[model samples]
Target: MKKAEEVRRLERDRIKNNIVVTSTDAKGKSHEDIIHAEQIGTKIITSELENTAGKERVMKNKHKQLQERIFINNKLTWEEREKRKKMKQRMEEEKKKGRTANMGYQKITIDGKQWK
Candidate 1:
């Protein structure tokens, strides 16, 4: 049989082990009463792929730079802008040529689901 002090200590330890934490997500939504180390619960915080987010951030920066160059930067002469456009076009064409020359085909199809 357990002593009275041991029973009280066990109850106190159980209460201390059950921890609750609240947190907010990227969308400014607040989560409440998030119990720790439980089987059933809502996600207190969300996660995303860093590479995907980095790609989106890079695209946004590129678009902003292009817009600034085309509209805001008046120091660039019209001829200079035209030259830049032509150079971009040439680069695009080169990329297309490279793609056509060596289009990679999947040879190892055994792990189809893993690839997918």
Candidate 2:
């Protein structure tokens, strides 16, 4: 009988010193009431996950925008389109040649004297 009363007293003390917190998520999902001490940790983890998900969503949206831009910008008259295509091909060729050629820096002449 004495041990039972002591256990009851301890349980009451524990409940009195602790708190239960309940939260709802963005999706209208309700979470179970958790101990107050754990609430901060739970919120931190939830925010981290939400932050990463937001970053991924933004990246996907940017990629979609880039694809749309490329398509829309390429829509032009045949002459203009062909001109742009040729310009792009020339740029690619220049890039390839630049990668293979290592032309050292040329001396810059200023006031009839070569500058370092």
- Which candidate achieves the best TM-score against the true structure? 2
Q: Give the local distance difference test score of model 1.
A: 0.34
lDDT of 1 by residue, 17-60 (tens): 23222232212222232232332234232222134343344334
The lDDT of model 2 is 0.35
Error of 2 at 71 (Å): 4.9
lDDT of 2 at 43: 22
- Candidate RMSDs in order: 23.8, 27.1
Candidate 1 deviant stretches above 4 angstroms: 1-74, 99-116
**Model 2 ranges off by over 4 Å:** 1-64, 67-71, 99-116
On a 0 to 100 scale, what is the lDDT of residue 115 in model 2? Answer: 31
